[model samples]
Target chain A: MRQETSRAQAPIPAVAGIGLRFPHHRAVREDRPAIGWLEVHPENYLGGGAAIACLEAVRRDYPVSLHGVGLSLGSVDGLDPRHLDRLAALVSRIEPGLVSEHVSFSTAGGTYLADLLPLPMTEEALETVCRNVEVMQTRLRRQVLVENPSSYVRYVASTIPEWEFMAAVATRTGCGILCDVNNICVSAANHGFDAYHYLAALPAAAVGELHVAGHALRELGGGRQIRIDDHGSAVSAEVWALLAAAVARFGRRPTLVEWDNAIPALDVLLAEAAQADTILSRERDHAQAA
Target chain B: MPKLRDLQAGFAEVVLAGRFDALAPYLPADAIPPEDRLAIYRNTARAVMTEALRLTFPAVERLVGRDFFAMAAARFVRQAPPDTADLAEYGVALPDFLAHLPEAAPIPYLADVARFEWALHQAATAEDAPSLDADALGAVAAEDQPMITFIPHPSVRLLELATPADAVADAVLAGDDRAMAAIDLAAGPRRLVLHRGATGVCAEQCDADAFAFARALFAGATLAGLVDAAPAAAGTLLAGHLASGRIAGYALQTQTGEP
Candidate 1:
């Protein structure tokens, strides 16, 4: 499936993009801002109505991508064909530039917890994720990028680091990576790993897109800070610094400003996208000068 | 250390079953309390499922207060988790769930109201099918009527309720109701066939013959068998339905024996 889809076409030229939310759909249709591209959660548009119509309108203008939040690719169970079919239908309808799912499972045994739960970095889980990605790509007749998930807990049984698990999935399935910098930072800080090491270890060629989002840190009774990847606030200064590092290393890729909770106004999200654009442009200049 | 499957399975238990005590020992010390971490999953599940329910029963939610709807929805979630990830297709059993609720028993018609809402929800998202043209129906011969079968609209759903619960849907849409108290159970024993009309979904009382025909169609019974079962009113029902565009296609229903 990956081999067949990869031959169809490469995505829109790697540059900064935005995750198009409903609040901003009208603005997107009216203003047509100069961003590299836009991405949306496929589940949100599964029903054909005002939302789907809005997406259709937006897709006509922007290079849209379908980023799935509920695929449960790493489930121990077999892939849900009905879910896959809905996604396929959406893909056919939107003709998105790229379609992606996280390397995490949100459901098991038919009940969906509906959060991107962590997958233990082991050979078995890697195989499960690869097979699922391959199945998804084959059914959709398209290649899909696998995004790294934010982890609140690390499994003691993990045999490899998150980067190695990610690279192995990309290598095995011939899929691309959606490097989510905020997730990397959140996981690293929570688990006591070096975020820079994670960035350095990623398979750069597999990185097809990037996700930058805001997060909040909550201090527990024991004084331990849990960095929640909430996507509720503005992109923090720390996350911006990390984005600079990632952009410097990987060059300008298709970056999306992901604010899922308590979404702000359109201009605010676009401004966040503009900030990412600044970093990507700066990186481009450095590359050119060098 | 537990294997990867063991860990994920344990985490699933924590999130879906609200069992965090067992998960505590497995959690890393540097991380937040496993229960709090688990609460994130709980909140997430609620948010995603609640959002799906909102889309499925917007009118119902508006009819009942959002807070009441959420409470009922939370109970429904615990009782019947989705069978698949296609969230649009997930909540089909919600009406049944509502029917058996002890607290909901007083609001006897609420279950049927939810049933109507579910039917509408299903109709809204079902695949689009082209309406059969008049020329196609005209092509059928009178001699071939014995073998005729009918296709109901892809979005057509028949629901029998104890009250005009559909009016609650209309009331909610009109924003006339501020609370669940506005629901009037005395208004019914209504037998409505909620279906997608040319413009959108509409509900109305299904006269006996039309109701029987719809039931037979949904059961995959042939038109001849449907007519034989309800011989007196079948012809009128058939004509009414055909003209209404409710019957979208027809095929021959072959009988096995002389009857």
Candidate 2:
């Protein structure tokens, strides 16, 4: 459990942020990339060596957000105290502006799948995630934003729509929502739902930060094309449109461009962040005009 | 309909083992079949874990090609699927796993190289702590200094490496896979101290006496006791150590009263 001082400052600025990975750490520090804020997967900085040093240097200039990937917030077996403890230690050390985790689960029976496996949109699943989110918030003493996961499959047991489940998590646990626009686009492509409808259904006030990443379109054997949420390529034109729609709906939150696999040069990530910035600026300008 | 926990349990089983039948009840038979849906998670899991192993044991991957390395990594993942939330901490049992791999039996040196690489990784990722300065060491009395113990840097790791790890690493860094394969691994065991220097984490070969003295000092053996018990040059070895960033900090015990 942590105690938050009322006068605490925001860990991240309300601007375009780039997902800070290891490959571009030196460049980000030396070149001092022009992106407004930086987000890091807290798991990478848990043990704390070079990553921590680079983060410390970067934090001096930019506010950071720890977007965690391995907390398994939806795990039915309960939160791993060890993982939480490591996260708590990292949170205390980094004092990030925003701490976020996925609404999907990753661990079960001591086995970690290492991916944000989707949760069933059932009341039970919602309650489980809400409880875990509460535990995380209480333990970290900071409200953690529960990000919607990209799912390739849906469970038969699920009665709730994904957005409704996301809303329930926030409504129940007082947690914020990290609406990954690309994930919504991917899941919509896979599940035959309109991405706009998904965005429209979200609780606007709970939107903490937004993630815009690229996805690859894969054609299955049956001539079925499904979008894979692989953050390997540049942000697709379609996802950018969805991002514009999301920004229009939720107003401009601190958006991050995530590129994990085969990460490009710092200039490339910075360019993507700049692209996001342009989109945000356009959206903000449009919002003010409206 | 099964409970959420039951669904996750079945889903985890299918993801880990590809046993979709067991998890069929939880999955909806949509346009994309349940098997195909689970395949996405399965592929992601294998790819993520395999990539982690490849990162941790790049030389091993280069030795046996990417295809074979991925296959072996898949097996290792099923055996140990990362207990730690941090991917950096995964592949703990990989060195041992490599030791017993029938495919890797020919290149027994690969396991040692993996161990070396793992140590280097550990040192690089170890907590960053401020190193002790000369002023801090100079503050202690000359007599009490002998009773002092030199603390190794948080990122310092010592290994008795004897394989072609060094040559392979050099070749790997040079982007010459052929040279890495041609490395002669029968080299005699070398005492090395792996530390994150100003440049980065590196493994430097050092004299056995120096390593022994450094190990003793790290183990809380006083300078005078190590001199009496250990072979000569322990003091000289530690002096060289203290002069560099290898000495993280220092502590004075004022003689623990043990001979």
Candidate 3:
């Protein structure tokens, strides 16, 4: 039964949302947090059973967004329709505020790497991504958001810049951009590019959501730090500062506090989300004061 | 002149086949040393995928120890990278891979044990649907029984094994290593009916009649047809299936395509 009111709520209103992981399911169900929204990995609920049942309960109170890490959107072998179909089914089930996938490819030929593998920022890659996004949107019957991936390696054949590639995908496919501040920080440090330049190059209006996460910095051989976006710890001060800047510029977007590995207690995750909500509030105040 | 496909292929090779020497030249120097960066991916791919195998094949891991299991898991991941993103489905091929592995030849039963565990993992995630009522079968007349296909509950799985796979899994789950060690060839060829009840996935030794009824239902055999084609112990089979939730709901095959 459709709600008689045709006026539906907007995609999480530029506030701090937390990533709803498996461990936190019970807690989230018991105590509904006063957070902006929630994000979940679509692949986790592919077949549907208890986990899907849990998520169905969570969806009633919160605006849910689907973030896909395993779609392998940039794979050269073309998009996997089976995965797309499952994703479409999930989207239909939850009616998530937004659906997003990484710009990285996780598989090649027929095998899945299961990691967020980087893609060369070439014209061919861009065309493949755009076409895939178009197909995905058509199948889902909704606009999708494309996120930039953190990388430890870059391709020599890549002529286009990461920001340019992201902007082009959004522009060509009519998709939205899910700008991840941690990815920008990691990619910038890895590739020796300016993070701000990458952010500035983005088509601002196309960005529908933002992602903020923690990273692990490993000391390399020559005093260089290899920062991996592990998302295991609390949001670092540096990433938080960058997010503040983003909110100031983009006027606040639905942001996610993603901690996949070494997930902390539900209270800890909620605290982190509260901190992000504070930043969003500060930005809103600044806009109002202006 | 590398196309998108060429780059993707090379990237996969570097990660899966350890062909990093070819991809090293293509990586930028500002990042970590190409090989070290590649090692991050390799270690990650190994760890994430190995964890799935460990979950499905805990008995195998217990038999070989953690260190050996990790090494075997890395090898399995390299051979059979997951076809889907669902991590639960990633380790389905580990048993097959173990069966053919030169190192695993000595422990021939290891593969079958892993297969049994994987089936349990699959059953845990299978979709749940209401089972057909046995009383509903009485309504169907004898003439129309041929078209009657009894749909088994989604939770029920028919596993026929020549080895004591069920006993091994039961012992492992019960934390009885001695029971696993005491298994002898004399105790061979057992069948198990695995189903998800109100509590969780319950595994039990199904009698011949019960097994036949479940299989017949899975094959879309109706009650009337099942009675004619079933073994002489058909009554006992229906009783056992009904006692458990294995026959949750059933429908006419002509009415519904599959259970």
Candidate 4:
């Protein structure tokens, strides 16, 4: 039996937040950036050392969200018991406002590949993903949001559209959707789908969070190119436009600006989050006027 | 349609094993060749796993240079893919993997340098534990002191390397070319004890006897056993370790009447 602590769970505001990576930990701690909130990958903190110690300190002033990249929620083998237990322990300790994992698997044949692999979006994959999401929710004893992945490949066997698959997971498992607007733009560009239609397919009420990140456009020969969700730069103007449309549809959600690689200074990340906050604020006013 | 399990297995083959044909039947052809799309996944997987290794073994990366490190890391990733998702727990086998690689033969000390860096990585993330209580030891009678056993802190790691791996790591990390040149490659068997405290991770070199004693204590040896194993400086070294919070807690064993 799990013992629930009396620590008050901080609710994440419908504003912009920054993905707290290792480089910005000192600045965030010492200078105490006036961001709306903070988000981090729980896997980094589970080992319990200086990283967790830093997260614990930062968690004091901000409403943190655990955005898991390694849960393999779409695995056919089901959720990894140890991973779930560790995540549950972290949730109990941190009492995060929102917990989320991708709508993709990172492990197969008992080997963790360490990158979010795309699912085929077939009925079988949907069943597997929904089952795993339910197991995750049961173990954590809370609703978790599932984020859409940026994919370069699509399978012929995929009967369901990607957005429909995301919606099915939320509907079947009673989970929330973490609409990564940047992923929608990237995947739509890669597979030739409308990013707005992808957003429209999702249940607006189920969208509890949004992620906006930068991507790299890699060029192939013959003027062909692919959008890579590298999350290593500023949010693109196309993604910002798609995010604006998503905000208009979903009204307001906890949007996060994620920059994982080639991370710039703290001010750059804050500026990205501020950009998101501006969109979120604009949407809130639009809703009020309507 | 193939079963989800089969689909995933085929997908893994495509991404990890580089067997693009394994999933060719499932992927619909378009302007982009199937191999090109699959290459994206393959590249990303290799890149992310390599990045994880680079994080844990920066000294090794620095020693071998980035290109060589990436080549070795890619091979290691395929050979011993992480069984768990917590990437911090990943790449435990890279040191041994590097040791056996043919290309790594030229740099004999590279493996040991990796081993040292891994120890430092482990020390940074190991679980926190309280230091041994001094008053509790005081409560024990003098005669029972020898029977006392220690509980080592989770952050403590004892390493005995055949090369001066610590010096190599320090020089490489500090980017001190002169210090790197000054080190003698023939130095044998550096014993170190690494632990995390209030400030950060610390690695300290010790003599043979002190290393033996600390290893024994970490292995759940009774004070009597530790002294018997390394009798020269058992008392002095034990006090120093306790003072430094290397011992998390301790237990006193009582002799059975039959024994």
Candidate 5:
């Protein structure tokens, strides 16, 4: 058994950072880009190898955050113990600034679907998510933030709004909320809701981090389209505006510019981070004025 | 409204089996038909699994064209979806899956290439450990040398393949069609040992006797047993592995009643 105080935790700063992917591992390790921090999917570094060794080297210079893509926090079958153990071991090894997983479930009936499947906004789901979050926190011996997912379809059984369900998870579990601004934009456009209202509903105190990413618009003909959260291209104008709104509502947080597919060069990601910093700075100036 | 577990099961059915009826009742009515909306999630799930396989088995994808690879990957995903979140561990069954696939039978060497690639993937991602100290081995009493059992590095893998898949994989990865064409499909079984060192993953072919010796040593055979298994090259092979740092550590086997 490992003690909670065995490793010291690094706190993420309230500034823009980049999501570190495999392609840029060499560049980031050798060049050591002048960025605020770096976040990675803990799943990638769970198994030791060149990947973990590289992460160890990079962690020396930057405050790394483990953003998990497959914890399946909302699954009714319960969390996978092996996966949790691997993640806990990684946390002990990395001692990241922050650790997080999605509000959706990817495993069902003993099969991992590989995509973040949406959960019905029902009381049962709320309970399941809270229970899973508590389990994760207990195993990891630390607080974990749950990020809201982007969805194209809504369930008829959903009673509570998406934002309320998210806020409830934080309130019930004492965990933080990682507000993905682009997901808010994509889900709002797909479901015909106000993104600003979604942002305002989140508990200010529970908001610990923010994410902004690119999404694709898929047309269904006849002047109708669904915004897919593919994170393929540049952040759209609408998402940038929504991110600005989130910053204003949540204040400056450790925001990340996420680009998973069609990732560009290191300079391009840094440019996106710089763009987010501009909005974050404006919020700081506004707070000073207030 | 279905229970949360039932809802997830139904959603998974829709995503994995394309059975929209299971989830149709839960979806709210929309301008886009419910099935079409559900397809978005389905497509993303398939794409994610496909991409995971592509990352691990790029040579397999190159051996088969993109469209064919995608089709095969989709089939494999549906048949054997991953049970864990760590994708690095996914796709372990693909080589066997392809070996039995009728379409892939035309390319008889494809499965072997995939097996070799999986070995490469495992070697690259296996845990890191300290190599054996050469000086420590010399200090052991000469009498105990025969009882010394060598421990192989965590990343070492020994494979006896029926085809010359390594050369084909090399050619395919390099996109040298001429080199790929020159490979003799009739080449007999080849024995290989793969290990990761300070530089990167390395694979080498060895003679049958040496292969058996290394395999036994890795399987925890004492020096005496290793020599019994392959008397011709046990000493030379052990020395070579020690020099290459393949042996991580060693232990002496005590007498039966000794503590």
Candidate 6:
């Protein structure tokens, strides 16, 4: 099955990009924005149609990444073969520069919950995630970046810290990291951890791609607000600061601005991408000068 | 300490059933109570499923209004959580679910509209196939042409509904809120051919004979058999479908099982 696809992709350039939602598909295909690359959810394009054609046209101009949201990489039951096969087919079709899935699991007991539910940072969960990551990398025949998930609940069974578990997955399975700064900020705020320390714990070389998105504040009963990573509006000031911290620690990586819900106009995203690009450009220049 | 499986099972229980008490054993007591954290996951699961259902069945959502549709969709998510991780492929039983809803009984055609929407979605996302061109058909000798079994692309779909679901679909597409209320169920039966041409998927109402011809083609009936069965308009049906790319490809069967 690994031999079925031979699409070798270069590491995505350390420039800013957008998540490429449907509203901006035409804008991307026609105008071919100045962003470095575009990322899409592979499940959305698993079946063919105008969506495939539209992406086909856009691909001619930009380096696309198939960031999967539904791989369920930490499921006790393991990954779905059919989903992997379809994803392999899509990877061959698009030849994306990067392929990634979350550290969280969305499916268990043959039922797929639509949300990316968090995993307990325990030895058992780590072993399961490493096993699933190995399966995905071998089946896809490409090193995939496993992202840290934003969480609301802290598991009582969690014996390890979030950063240690993420680093352990990379060390054991040789998988790369899709370090989502917004998610780190969200989880950090929720769990009362410093986001900067979380960024510092990751192996710099393992950080292959970065995700920055907008989140909403969910006010609970006890004057506690959960920073929900909704990706609806503009990138927050706090998340931008965290992204700056990550870039400073890990150097400029291929960053993506993902705005999934209540998507604004294409220019709004471009503006966000521009903000990231400015940060990237400044960091690169600083590294070169130093 | 609970195992990973127990924790996940507990989490799924919290998200799916909102049984926070059962899940509390695995959830840590933090600044916020464990139940509050569980509530976040519960809300997320329902919200994501609701949004997916709304995207797949927008017309039904529009027909029922937001609050009513959200309530119905939430109930549906509990009854039938997605089997596949792909939300695009989820909601396979929505039409059937709507069919049995007591609240939906007042507008019996809502289920029909959902079915129509799902059909369109299937057509839109179905695989693109290579259509057999005129050159290939021309090369096949005229005598052997009738024996050819033309294949429709996987993108082809048909909707036969009693209600004027097509008109309601049109109103939804046009974003005409007023037109929905004035919908006429008296417009007669709809037998629509939803096919993906070179441009995109389009829906056109077909008469009985044309629909029968489409159904047969979809079922892999050979041209000569179809022509012989309905010889009166064989020429028109064949010509129309062949040009439309609905006749995607063809195969001539061997009489002796040796091609």
lDDT of 5: 0.92
lDDT of 1 at B65: 74
Cα DockQ of the candidate 2 complex: 0.66
Lowest-scoring 10 consecutive residues by lDDT in candidate 6 chain B? B3-12
Listing candidates in order, what is each one's chain A TM-score?
A: 0.94, 0.95, 0.95, 0.97, 0.96, 0.95
Highest DockQ against the true fold, candidate: 5
Q: What residue pairs clash in candidate 6, if any at all?
A: B146-B224
lDDT of 3 by residue, B1-259 (tens): 6777777777778777778886777776654578888888767877778876887778888767799788788787777788877787788778788888898787777787887887787777777676556677678777775566555677677787777876776777688979878887456666788877767788787666666667776777766667786758666777677767777565555655666
DockQ of each: 0.46, 0.66, 0.63, 0.77, 0.82, 0.71
Candidate order by lDDT, decreasing, is 5, 4, 6, 2, 3, 1
lDDT of 6 by residue, A1-290 (tens): 55652322335789998998899888888887788888999988888888888887787777889999888998999999999999999988888899999999888787888788898888989999999999999998989999999988887678899999999999999999999999998999888998898999999999999999999998876777777888888999998888888899999999999999899999989999999998888898899999
lDDT of 3 by residue, A1-290 (tens): 97563322536767889999988899888898777788999888876457787888888888888999888888877778888888888887788888999998988887788788888888988888888888888999888999988988888788998999999999899999999998998878877898887887898899899999989998976777788888989999988988888887777899899998899998898899888988989988998999
Q: For each candidate, what is the lDDT? A: 0.79, 0.83, 0.81, 0.90, 0.92, 0.86
Q: TM-score of chain B only, all predictions?
A: 0.83, 0.89, 0.85, 0.94, 0.94, 0.90
* Model 5, span B61-125: residue lDDT tens: 99899999999998998899999999999988999999999999999999999999999999888
> Judged by TM-score relative to the true structure, which candidate is superior, 2 or 5?
5
Error in Å for residue B145 of model 6: 3.7
Alpha carbon deviation, residue A117, candidate 1 (Å): 0.6
Alpha-carbon TM-score of each model against the true structure: 0.87, 0.91, 0.92, 0.95, 0.96, 0.93
> Interface RMSD values for the candidates, listed in order?
2.3, 1.4, 1.7, 1.0, 0.9, 1.3
Which candidate gets the maximum lDDT versus the true structure? 5
1 versus 6: better lDDT goes to: 6
Model 4, range A40-82, lDDT digits (tens) per residue?
A: 9999998868898888888888899999999998899888899
What's the candidate order when arranged by decreasing TM-score? 5, 4, 6, 3, 2, 1
Q: Model 5 over residues A1-290: C-alpha lDDT tens digits?
A: 96554322378999999999999999999999888999999999887679999898888888899999988998999999999999999998898999999999999988998889999999999999999999999999999999999998899999999999999999999999999999999999999999999999999889999999999999999898999899898888898999889888888999999999999999999999999999999999999999
How displaced is residue B210 in candidate 6, in Å? 1.9
